[model samples]
Target chain A: MITIVAKSIVKEGKLETFKALAQEMVEKSRKEKGCITYQLYQDIHNDHVMTFIEEWEDMESVEAHQKTEHFEKNVPKMKALRHPSSEMTLYKKYI
Target chain B: MITIVAKSIVKEGKLETFKALAQEMVEKSRKEKGCITYQLYQDIHNDHVMTFIEEWEDMESVEAHQKTEHFEKNVPKMKALRHPSSEMTLYKKYI
Candidate 1:
């Protein structure tokens, strides 16, 4: 299995904008064939920090996700609202 | 459940130190009462990027972890090995 954790800092004052986009992204991602789970979370202490937890069937599906229309389309727009900084990590499940 | 994904940039050349600390942390965490899973992953593309994904029974267990001796002992040392900068997120599991 493959897991991805994406963290981003939303530009101040754009919290609602980010959430709306995330809602769309999560809904679409959860319906994909290889997607096991897709979840969104925000820090209780820091609203600006948001994260996405994803589990996929394998690395191939994860790579394919990067090319999906939902990802390519919303990501650019979401990036615009971010703090010019973000990070992504891919993991091959290791218990 | 409370899930935590911790991302940290190891100080240059401190990969071994980080791994040793992580190994200790994961082993100890998995034995704790509420811990369901504790995992560590390194970026396939960048060795400097490392992440820890943890699942717990509840927020209380996660909060308790912060005060655990293993945590208090290793975290400071790990922090010292980290790039002066890093990030941590606490996720209330939502799918």
Candidate 2:
């Protein structure tokens, strides 16, 4: 499986909207084939920092997720809510 | 539960040592009363970049984890294997 850690620093006052949109994305993502897990998290020390830890069956699945209507539509909206310099990393299980 | 995403950039040639030490830490951590999950991953695009996605029952469990013999002994070793800008972030489930 492939794991993705997506981090973003939200623009001030956009957290609630971001969360709502993210929830919709997550719900849709969960229904996709090859989605093992799709969940959102908020930084405990910094409320403005949000994260999504996702697991997919493989690279094809990830690509499929990116092409979904929900993803294509909402990801830009989500990005608009974030500050510059936010990051994402994809990892392979090593242990 | 509380989640922690710990990222580290391993020093060149130290990935094996870091992984071995991390495995020891994960095994010990999993036995802790409040540890829900403790697993390691390596960035697929950058092999030297490692991450630990951990889950604990609460803040107290996390504190207790830091004080354990395995943690106290191995964390520094892991740090010594890492580059200077490695980061750790704690998160609370928001979805």
Candidate 3:
């Protein structure tokens, strides 16, 4: 399985909207094939920082996820709510 | 529960040693009270980057963990293995 860690710093005053969008994405993504988990987290120390920790069966699953309607629609909206330097990295389980 | 996402870039040639140290930390940490999960992951796109996704029952549990012998001993070693600009963040689950 592969994991994706997508972290971003949400712009001030846009957290609620961003979160709503994220929740929609999560809810839809979780129903997709090969999706083991899809959850959103907000930094306790920095409320503006948010992350999505996701588990997928393979790279194909991840690619497919990006093509979904929810992804295609919401991701750009989410990005517009974030500051610069946001990052998303795919990881291979090591332990 | 609270989560912690610790990301770092391991120095060249230090991945193996870092993984070994991380494994030991994970084993010891999982046995600690309030620890739900403590796993290490390596970035697929950048082999030198690693991340730790952890869950704890509360902030106190996290504080207690920092005082553990295993944490004290290994975290420093792990830091030494990493390049500059590494970061550890505490998060509150929003979903």
Query: lDDT by residue for model 3 over B1-95, one digit each (tens)?
Result: 99999998999999899989999998899999999999989899889999999999999999999999999999999999998789898999888
Give lDDT tens digits, candidate 3, residues A27-92.
999999999999899898888999999999999999999999999999999999999889998999
Model 1 CA lDDT for position A56:
93
lDDT of 2 by residue, B1-95 (tens): 99999999999999899989989988889999899999899999999999999999999999999999998899999999999989999999998
* Model 3 chain B weakest 10-residue run by lDDT: B83-92
Instruction: Output the TM-score of candidate 3.
Output: 0.96
At residue B90, candidate 3 shows an lDDT of: 93
Compare candidates 2 and 3 on lDDT and give the better one. 2
Ordering by lDDT: 2, 3, 1
DockQ for model 2 equals 0.88
Candidate order, TM-score descending: 3, 2, 1
In model 3, the clashing pairs are none
TM-score of each: 0.86, 0.96, 0.96
Cα lDDT tens digits for candidate 1, B1-95: 87788888898889898889889999998899899988988776678778888888988888888889999999999999998667777876433
